[model samples]
Target: MAKGIRFHYLHRDSGNYKKFGHRDFSNPNNLTVEEITQRIRQALIDTEFFYPEKVGIPKFLFHRYGDDFSWYEFESVEEIQTHYLHESIEGFIAKLLRDG
Candidate 1:
């Protein structure tokens, strides 16, 4: 099964795009990836199913030329492209901003 996760996104003034993921906290406001492994110290006090211990950003994403820049799991890449064909330029802008 595909693992799905929601991210925290910070928008821009032009409403062009919003950046998300661990980058929002660690990177230079760019793309970043974090991997966490859960650990429970005291099962009695901690009711959470999982408690993550490690938190670090991916090295490559913030780089100008990185794999993530070329390809990312954008929520709505296709819909924005379609709007360019069927509507005005603003319509394309509208669709692109809807991405997460």
Candidate 2:
């Protein structure tokens, strides 16, 4: 009963996309959303994608597909460090670009 989560990020210059995820949940039903988010954040940080002076918060999104197909948009480094729920990344980005 392992839950799956995937991370997608776009390279600003190259316009290429990168993806990552975990499949073995060990007991997805027992895990909370916060725990899942923490693991995702840790994995991204380990990749040096959140370095302040370097890349900062990479333009990334996370998706949990299947029964619970959801999308998450990373706003900032601080926001990613905290736990939150998933929304539509594409919609969020569109709104930001349109409104701001």
Candidate 3:
């Protein structure tokens, strides 16, 4: 089987980056969307459990709250096949069960 890809979700944790670090997401001075996204992608790779297709980061917060990360699980990649255009965690799980 081809290895699954992990996707990391991200957002500001604090008002500024002082508590976290210079490159922290919460830092007002650190306004780099590409850099932030890159960090998230890196985190996902480090974790290596979640799949990118099943994960999403909406332009606007879907479940607006603290921490700014959410995750779903799958048994196989087929569960994630149709999510490119229209995907959700629930669909991913359902498709996973349906395929197997």
Candidate 4:
């Protein structure tokens, strides 16, 4: 099986970046029409897991399979599979269950 990918989901508690601070979505360069649409679509979804009061949205920061410094924002983990040979943690578990 291929190696799994590493990613960090950014929330309020994450370290502040130079421009966007802890919220990458706040950056104009990072915001997209798709993201705006997604926000509205997921607005009813609970965010208490990452925020105290459904305040912040979960944003994925994925890095290249082996390189730590190559982090990039992606809409979803499944999207990463289209570009890299790495798999998500959920995918890893599913494969294990099927192959075992």
Candidate 5:
């Protein structure tokens, strides 16, 4: 069986990073990386879970293992698009699901 990938929303303050929440696909097999990315982008824009006046835009991070993970701090949609083009969803997910 294949492992699933998960993403966590984080907030950084004075060099400290804390997890606020996470988005995990209930049926990961049916969801593609593009879909997940789009969902995350929408979440960022909605800002319903964040207080911009108090905390600013939050950072996004993904991990499926204790040590294997990637962090992204995007300022605009263009940057996210660029990252998607350069990073393969399969590869990223594979890394995420890898065990230490």
Candidate 6:
């Protein structure tokens, strides 16, 4: 499991990515697939309203980089939730380890 995950939002004011929040899960690899999905859902709740600079398209994502600096971009909460149902934990982990 990852040591931590960072949540970023494309800021409306500066038009750049800004760190909003993060979590350091304790033994995330031990978590069941459902537990992982639920945790992500709860974290994303109402985050669209976080640190708004102007009314525009929501550009929020959560990502975690491995020691090699490879990361996977989860474009939205809905996309994350949907993928979890169809993808295996091993496959997801592989993507996290492989993608940037």
lDDT of each: 0.23, 0.32, 0.30, 0.29, 0.37, 0.32
List of clashing residue pairs for candidate 6: none
Best by TM-score: 5
Shift in Å, residue 96, candidate 4? 19
Lowest summed lDDT over 10 consecutive residues: which window, candidate 5? 75-84
Residue 88 in candidate 3, Cα distance off native in Å:
27
Q: Work out candidate 3's RMSD over C-alphas.
A: 16.7
Encode model 5's per-residue lDDT on 17-40: one tens digit a residue: 444544332332445646655644
TM-score of 5: 0.32
Model 2 over residues 14-54: C-alpha lDDT tens digits? 22233432211122243454554554454443332332213
Q: Alpha carbon lDDT of residue 78, candidate 1?
A: 13
List candidate 6 stretches off by more than 4 Å: 1-14, 20-22, 47-100
Q: State the displacement of the C-alpha of residue 44, model 2, in Å, after optimal TM-score superposition.
A: 2.2
Model 2, runs deviating above 4 Å: 1-13, 16-24, 46-100
Tens digits of per-residue lDDT, candidate 4, 1-100, equal 2222332232222233311212222221323444433442343224212221233223335322332322222223212112334333433323223321
Stretches off by above 4 angstroms in model 5 are 14-24, 46-100
Can you give the TM-score per candidate against the true fold? 0.18, 0.24, 0.22, 0.19, 0.32, 0.24
lDDT of 3 by residue, 23-66 (tens): 10122232244443343333443422333334332233243455
Worst 10 residues of 2 by lDDT: 73-82
Clashes of 6: 0
Ranking by TM-score: 5, 2, 6, 3, 4, 1
Model 1 clash pairs are none
